[model samples]
Target: MLNIGVLVSGGGTNLQALIDAQKSGIIHSGRIVTVVSNKPGVYALTRAENAGIDAHVITKKECGSSDAFDAALCAYLQKMQVDVVVLAGFLAILGDSFLLVYKDRILNVHPSLIPSFCGDGFYGLKVHRAALDYGVKVTGATVHFVNEITDGGKIILQKAVDVLEEDTPETLQKRVMEEAEWKILPEAVELVCSGKVHV
Candidate 1:
């Protein structure tokens, strides 16, 4: 089975979805080996622990520089024999060394469709706000391979949601997240694990 290492910086709702998918046999060829968080006190760690997965925090303060943190993260993944690294709301921009080592093995779920409302400073609610401001009739999520550039990876999957007439950032986010992210994230992971996706 493919062993996955999940990285998160927030509530881990997507992580939970992966766990649920694994249990429900939707994702049959892989299992989450460990969960790593850059911040302490994130509920993602608790979610990992509750699922009996090994979970730990590797704070930025612990590793003085981005290079140092990447080194540590690489070492940890090596030790765990992780086959894939899944970024679930992980905020840090990874160093080149990490990208080189993991390459196509790292995957991320972005809140917006690629080549549109993506790039640095576009994440979480910010993405939703951008979609609303742009007055786009349709906006959704993208699951892609992770590279050096933020959200610049090759798109593996995408699901679109309509931007309604009375949509606020929060409401749009809620709808899109439910209709797309909740399904696509886990499905993307499964595709990677099953050898169906190539970079």
Candidate 2:
């Protein structure tokens, strides 16, 4: 089985989805071995602990530089022999140094369809808000590889969710998470782990 190391920065809703998927045998090709958080004391860490997964914190402030943070994160993931890295609600921006080593091995789930309300300055509720502002009739989630460009890697899976007329960013965010992010994120993991998708 492949080892998956997840990176998180806040509430681990996506991580929880993966854990549930694993428990239900939706992801049998790989197992999540460790979870690293960029922010300490986030609920994501608690979720990791509850799932019996090893959890640790490595903040940019702690490392004192982007390069340092990347080095630290890469070192830890390498030490754990992680075959795949999943950025589940991970807010920290990874640098090229780290990206070079992991290359296509890193995967991330964006809240909105890529090339839309995505890229720098678009994350969390901001993505939903942008879609609403743009009056998009449909907004969804995307699972893609992590490259140097923001949300610019090859996409693996995407599931669209309707944009309700009476939706706030928060409401739309919840719906997208339930209808798209939670589903395809695990499916994408299965695809990557099972060798169905690759560079």
Candidate 3:
């Protein structure tokens, strides 16, 4: 089984999805071994604790620099023998050291259909708001490999959701999470763990 290490910064809805998926056997050949959050008191850590998984908080203020923080995070994952690193709402920017160490072993779930409402500055509600503002008929989520450039990673899977005129960013975000993000993130993890996914 692949040892999965999840990184989170906020609510951890995606992390919950992975946990549920693993429990349901939707994510085969892998299990969440640890959860790391940059901020303390985040609900994600609570979820991990409730699930009896080892959870950690490594605040950036203590790390001194972004590179240092990334290195520290990578070290923790390596120590845990993590086979896959999933960025589930993890807001920290990982540097070259981390990226090079993890390489295609790292994955991220973006809230948009990628190449649209993605890249720098497009996160959380901002992605949905941009999609609504652009008047796009459909918007969804993308699961991709993590690379040097933000959200510029190679795409693994994408699932689209229809846009409704009455939808707000909050509603749209929820829809995308349910219809796309939550579903695919675990599947992508499974694919990688099962050796079906190629870099």
Candidate 4:
């Protein structure tokens, strides 16, 4: 079974989807060994705790530098023998040391179709707002291999949702998230677990 570590920074809706998929036998061959977060008091940690999974808060404030934080995070994942790292709303940009160590084993879920509304300072509601403002006809989500450059990874899977003429950012995000993230994230994680994903 693939032992996975999920990293999250907020509500962790995607993380919840992974847990649900595993429980429902859609993903029968893997387990979430740990859930790590950089922020404190996130509901994601609470969800992990309720599920009885090992959860950790590795706040950036506690570490001296990004390198040090990555080192500590890597050490923890190694201790858990994590086979894969899933970024579920994790906002921190991972350092090169962490990427080098994990390499092809790390995956990320982006809220928008990448190479468009993704990069520095683009995340969460901001991405959805951008898509709406730009009057794009279609915007969706992407699941990709994690690399050092922000969202600059090989795409594993993508699902598109139409940007309706009457859609506000919140409305568009809700619709896209339902069709894109709710399906794509778990599917991508399953692909990784089943060894179907290649770098």
Candidate 5:
């Protein structure tokens, strides 16, 4: 079985999806063994605690530098023997050290289809807002490996969600999460864990 570690900064709705997927046996070969949050008192930690998963905190300010935080994160993940790292709404910028150590082992779920409203300054509702502002007929989610470039990783899975005429950023975000992010993220994890994904 692949031991998974999740990094979070917010509500962790995607982390919940992974937990639920494991419980349902949908994720056949991977299990979320730890959840590390960048912020304290976030609902994501609560979610992790309620599920009986080990949870921790590593605030950037506490680490004193981004590099230190990234190094600490790498050490923690290695100590836990984590085989896969999932970025489930994790907001902190992990330094190159973490990326090099984990390589293709780290997975990230982006709110929009890549090569679109992704990269720096495009996160959370901003992604959905960009899609709406551009009046795209379809906006979806992408699950990919974590590389040095933000959202510029090898695509594992993608699912498209239709945009409604009256859709707001909030509504579009919800729809993408429900129809795409929630589904493909776990599926991608399962694929990696099962040794089906080549890289």
Candidate 6:
């Protein structure tokens, strides 16, 4: 079985999805062994602890530099023997050293379809707001491997969600999470764990 490590920086709603999916037998080829949060006092850590998963914190400020943070994160994950790294709601970008070490082993779930409202400065409700401001009729989620470029990696899975006429950024965000992000993220994880998704 593959050992998974989840990285988070927020509420961990996607982390919750993976935990629930694993409990339901939706994930069998791998299991979440550890959770690392970049930001301390986040609800994600609480969620991890509630699920009986080991939780940790490592921040850039503590490491004094991005490169050091990357090295620290790499060392910790390596020590844990994590086979797959899932960036559920993780915010900090991984530096080159870390990316080179993990390579295609990291998976990230972005809020919008890539090549769209993605890359730097596009995250959280900003992505949804961008779609709405542009009057898009459809917006969705994308699950892909994490590379050196922001949101630039091999696509694994994508699911589209309609943007309603009356939808606000907050509402659209909720709908996209429910209709797209929640579903495809876990499916993508299962695929990677089961050898169905290849780099």
Task: Please count the clashing residue pairs in each candidate, in the order shown.
Answer: 0, 0, 0, 0, 0, 0
Q: Could you give me the TM-score of model 2 versus the true structure?
A: 0.99
Candidate 3 least-lDDT 10 residues: 65-74
Q: How close is candidate 1 to the true structure, as a TM-score?
A: 0.98
Compose the digit string of candidate 1's lDDT tens values, residues 36-117.
9999999999999999999988877899988899999999988999989999989998999999999899999988888788
Displacement of the residue 159 alpha carbon in candidate 1, Å? 0.4
Q: CA lDDT of each candidate?
A: 0.91, 0.95, 0.94, 0.90, 0.93, 0.94
Model 6 has an lDDT value of 0.94
Judged by whole-model lDDT over C-alpha atoms, candidate 3 comes out at: 0.94
* Poorly placed runs, candidate 2 (over 4 Å): none
Tens-digit lDDT track for model 3 on 132-158? 999999999999999999999999999
Residue-by-residue lDDT tens digits, candidate 4, 9-127: 99888889888888887776679999999999999999999888999999778998898999999999999999899999898989999999999989998888888899889988899
Better of 1 and 2 by lDDT: 2
Alpha-carbon shift of residue 163 in model 6 (angstroms)? 0.3
Model 5's lDDT to the true fold?
A: 0.93
Q: What's the residue-level lDDT of 179 in candidate 3?
A: 96
**lDDT value, residue 4 of candidate 5:** 98
Worst 10 residues of 2 by lDDT: 112-121
Best by lDDT: 2
- What clash pairs does model 4 have? none
List ranges where model 1 is wrong by over 4 Å: none
- Regarding lDDT, does 1 or 5 come out ahead? 5
TM accuracy, model 3: 0.98
Candidate 5 regions with alpha-carbon error over 4 angstroms: none
Error of 2 at 133 (Å): 0.8
Write model 5 residue lDDT over 1-199, tens digit each, in one string.
9899999999999999999999999998989999999999899999999999999998888989999899888899899999999999999888898999998999999988888899999999999989999989988999999999989889999898999999999999999999999999999999999999947
Residue pairs in steric clash, candidate 3?
none
Displacement of residue 171 (Cα, Å) in model 3 is 0.8
Clashing pairs in 6: none
